[model samples]
Each structure stands twice: as structure tokens, then as C-alpha cells.
Target: MTTITTRTVEYPADNLTMIGYLALPAGAERRPAVLIGPEGTGLSDVERRRAEALAELGYVALAFDLHGGRYLEEPEEMLARCMPLLADPDRMRGIGHAALDVLRAEPRADPDRTAAIGYGTGGAVALELGRDGVDLHAIATVNALTTGRPGEAARIRCPVWAGVGSEDPIMPPAQRVAFTEEMQAAGVDWRLVVYGGALHAFHHPSVDHTVRPGVGYHPRHAQRAWRDVVALLAECLPVTD
Candidate 1:
């Protein structure tokens, strides 16, 4: 196994102090970087572990914060915060760019070779970054099949890949179609993967709470989604030794 290091990173965004996690590989050489966004519940061990795993794969990864270090356990609270943020592209871009700044500041991060992968609300942020023309190598999101404002997706210059549970109520078929249509209209190099028999947040194993209807974990699908994401990164943002 490759050696990796992790540390807490605190930055300002949305007029709040955002605490994030940064993971780096063993060597000092600059490498492809990844901006990891957490779900609406905020940054947790799930995202931190993901950053570490990416570091092990030779990429500098930063799991940036979403809610000023607050983790929302209640479904209502999470929805209240995320819904508005999703509707406001400028705010989402601000949050994403703040963390992108942190990631680029790292000595081991190759700014030009960066990608963004996120989950849920975090995924939406990743999409917003691409829409804002951040010059990402790739943009990948899970359980965040949401459409952007009209004509904004044209600014996305990289390959976009999204995965969602077929049964996800939040991202139902209509929403998926809208998202795909937006991407298609923009002429983006995009792909969407639907995991059958899975629901919203299927990649999250520890979220056992019945926070809402049609949301649960599917362990097998979770693994498959991760493998797919890794493949997308390899194709679009390969890291060299």
C-alpha cells in the first residue's frame, strides 16, 4: 500500500468557516488533484476516507466542507439548506471555488490536472464548478443528477460523468432526462450510469437512518459505482509516476 497523509483544512466560504480534509500521496512531486465534495449533510468520514483512497491511488484529493463543519442528521434540515443552494448557481460556484483554491494551493496539487467528484449536494457543487468554467479535466457526480440554469452548461469544457440509482425519488427519471438533455445541448462529453435496484445515497453504507422514503444503501452497487468513478478518472485524468 502506498503511504499517504491527511490533515484538516479550514477556509472561508458563504460567510462561514468551512472545514475540509486534504490527502496527499507519499512523494513531493506534483500530481493530478481531485476536489471531493460531500453530501448535504456535510463533510464526514465517508468523504475523508475517499480522499485517502484517492491519495493512495497517487492523486492529491481534498474533501472540502459544505456546511461550515456542520453535519445535518435530520432530513428536513438538510433539504432546507440544500434546496436553495442547488437553485443558486453562484453560491454553489463560490463554495466550490473556495475549496478549489485550497486544493490548488497544495504543493503536491497540479492545478491543470484537477477533477471534481462529489456526492449528493456535493455533486451538485461539482457540476456548478464545471458550469462556471473551472477548467477541470473531468467532472463526476453520484446521486446528483440535477439540471443547471439554461445555457450555463455550455461553459463546461471537460468530460462529465454522473451516476444515480434508478429508483432515486429525488432524481427521478424526469430529472435524469433533464440533466442529460442539458448536457447534450451543451455538446459535453458526458455519460450517465444508472444502477438498478438502488436508491438515493446507495453509496453511503453508514447512513442507515430512514431519513426519507426511497433512500438506502446498496453495498454491491456502491462498490460498482466507485469502480466506475475510478475508471472515469483514469480515462480523463491519469496520474503519472
Candidate 2:
């Protein structure tokens, strides 16, 4: 088995010190890298594990924090912090850029061959990075399909892929249409996949009692989404052997 290393990294963003989890694959040669953004509940073991998994697949992965090192188990707290942050594109860009800086600084990361993938509120952050004109090969998001300001998406030069649950009220059909229209108007290479019968956050595992209303897990769809994400990375930012 290929060796993998994990560590805690600290950086500054949005006027706050943020803690991120980084995973590196074995070998000294530089490889493609990915920046991972967690759900609105903040960075948790879920995102950390995803980073490690990516490292195992021969890519450097960094799962950055959203709320300093705290994980919000309470729905209200998560919304209170995420809603406002999502509304401010500048703030979201700041957070994404901070983490991207850390990832690019890694010796094993190929700065020019990088991608961004996020979940929930973190997904919006990833989209913001693409909209802010960050040079990335690909961008992927799940369960967070928010549309950006007029003409701003044109700044995104990378191909984008987004996945959401078809029944998710948070990202309803209308919202999905709007997001796709924005991508279309921007002339971006984009694709959207709606997992049938799935709910919001279907990619997320159950966290305590946080499962409520339109939010729950669909194990089958979750695995499929991960595979789709991996495929996206392979197509856009492949790590050659």
C-alpha cells in the first residue's frame, strides 16, 4: 500500500485563523492536487477522511476549515454562520484563496494542476473561487448549487460539475435551473447531475441528530457521487504515473 501522511495546517482567512487538514501521498515527485471544502457544519472527520482517500489515490488533498476548527452539530448555528458567509462573495473567495494558497505551497502539489471540490456551504466557496478567476483545472460541488452575481461566472475558466439531490428543497428545481442558466450564459463547460429520490446532503453521512426535514443520507447515491467526482478529477486534472 502507498504510504500517506496527514497533518493539521493553520492559515488566516476572513480575519480569522483557520485550521485545515492536509493529506499527502507517498513519493517526492509533484502530483496533481485538490482543495476540499466541507459542509456548512464545518470541517469534520468526513472531509478529513475524504482527503486521506484522495491521497491514497495518488493526489495531494487538503480539506480546509470553515469555522476555525469547530464542527457545528447544531443546525441553527451552522445556518447562522454559513448563510451570511454565502451571501458575501468576497468573503467566500477569501476563504477559498487562503486554503488554495496552503495547498499550492505543498511540495508535492503541482500548482498548475489543481482542482476544487466542496460540499454544502463549502461548495459555494469552491464556486466562488472559480468565479473569482482562480486558475483551476476543474471545480465540483455537491448539495450546494447557488448561483452567483451577473456576469461573474464568466471569470471561471475551468470546467465545473455539480451534483444535487433531485428532491432537495434547499436546491429545488427552480434553483437548479437558475444555476444552470448562469453557467450557460457564462459560456462555461459545465454539467449537472441530479440524484433521483435523494434528499439534500445525500452525500453527507449522518451527524448526530442533524438529520432533519429535507436533509438525509442516501448511501448508494453518496458512493456514486464520489465516483463521479473522482472521474471529474481524472478527466480535468489527471495525475499521471
Candidate 3:
């Protein structure tokens, strides 16, 4: 197994002191970087582990925080914060840019070669970054099918891939169709994969805390989504030895 290092990074975003998890691969050579966005519940061990996994794969990865340093286990709290934030595009872009700046500042991250992958609310932030005209090699989102302002998707300069649970009421078929239509109208390369028989947040593991109805995990689909994400990165931002 390749040795990797991990650390906590504090940065400012969305009027909060964001605490992000940064993972670096074994070598000192600058490498392709990726931003991992957490779900609406905020950053947690799940996202940190993902950053570490990406680092092990030879990419510098930073799991950016959404809620300062706290994780909201309560559905009410998560929605209270995320709902309003999701409605505002500029705010999401602010958070994304702050995290991207921190990632690029790291010595091991290659600023010119980067990608963004996000889940839930974090996924919306990733899409916001693309709509804001940030240069990215690739963008992938799980369960976040947010459509941007009219004609804003024209700013996206990279391929976008999104995965969602077929039965996710939060991101149902209509929302998916709207999102894809916007992407197509803007002439951006995009694709969407719907995991059959899954629900919202299907990529996430089941938790002990109370969750909204129609939210559950599908282990098989989660693994498949991860593989698809890795493939997207390999195709768009290959890490060189």
C-alpha cells in the first residue's frame, strides 16, 4: 500500500471557519488535485476517508467542510441550513472557491489539473463552481441535480457526470431532466446515471441517527458510483507517475 499523509486545514468560507481534511499521496511530486464535498449534513469521517482513498490513488484530495466544524445529525437542522444555502448560487460559489484556493495552495497539488466531486449539498457547490466559470478538468455530483440560472451553464468548461438514486424524491426525474436540459443547451459535455431501486443519499452508509423518509444507502450502487467517479477522473485528469 502506498503511504499517505493527512491533515486538518482551516479556511474561511460562508461566514464560517471551515475545517477541511487534506490528504497527500506518498511522493513529493506535484499531483492532480480533487475536491470532495460532503453531504448536506456536513463534513464527517465518511468524507475524510474518501479524501484519504483518493490520496492513496495518487491524487491530492481535500474534503471541504460545509458547516464550520460540526456535523448535523438532525434532519431539521440540516435542512434549515442547506435549504436556504442551496437557493443562493453566489454563496455556494464562495464556499467552493475558498476550498479550491486552499487546495491549490498546497505544495503537492497541481493547480492546473483539478476536479470537483461532491455529494448532496456539497454536490450543488461543485456545480456552482462550474457555472461560475472556474476551470476544472472534471465535475461529478452524487444526488445533486441542481440547475443553474438561465444560460449560466455555458460557463462550464469541463465534462460533468452525475449519479442519483432513481427513486430519490428530493432529486426526482423532473429535476434531473431540467438539469440535463440546461447542460445540453449550454453545449457542455454531461451524463447522468440513475441507480435503480435506490433512494436519496444512496451513496451514503446507513446511520444510527434519524433520517428523512426515502433516504437510505445501497451498498452495491455506492461501490458502482465510486468506480464511475474514479473512471471519470482517470479519463479527465490522469495522474502521471
- How would you encode candidate 1's per-residue C-alpha lDDT over 77-151 as one tens digit per residue? 888998899899999999999999999999999988999999999999999999998899999999998788889
- Best-performing candidate as measured by lDDT: 3
Candidate 3, lDDT over the whole model: 0.96
Candidate 3 lDDT tens digits, 1-241: 5599999999999999999999999989999999999999999888899999999999999999999999999998988999999999999999999999999999999999999999999999999999999999999999999999999999999999999999999999999999999999999999999999999989888873356799998999999999999999999999999
Per-residue C-alpha lDDT of model 2 across residues 18-39, encoded as one tens digit per residue: 9999999998899999999998
Ranking by lDDT: 3, 2, 1
Q: Worst lDDT window (10 residues) for model 1?
A: 205-214
Backbone clashes for every candidate come to: 0, 0, 0
The TM-scores, one per candidate, come to 0.97, 0.98, 0.98
- What is the alpha-carbon RMSD of candidate 1 to the true structure? 1.2
Candidate 3 clashing pairs, residues 3+ apart or interchain: none
Model 3 spans with C-alpha error above 4 angstroms: none
lDDT on C-alpha atoms for all candidate structures: 0.93, 0.94, 0.96
> Higher TM-score: candidate 1 or 2?
2
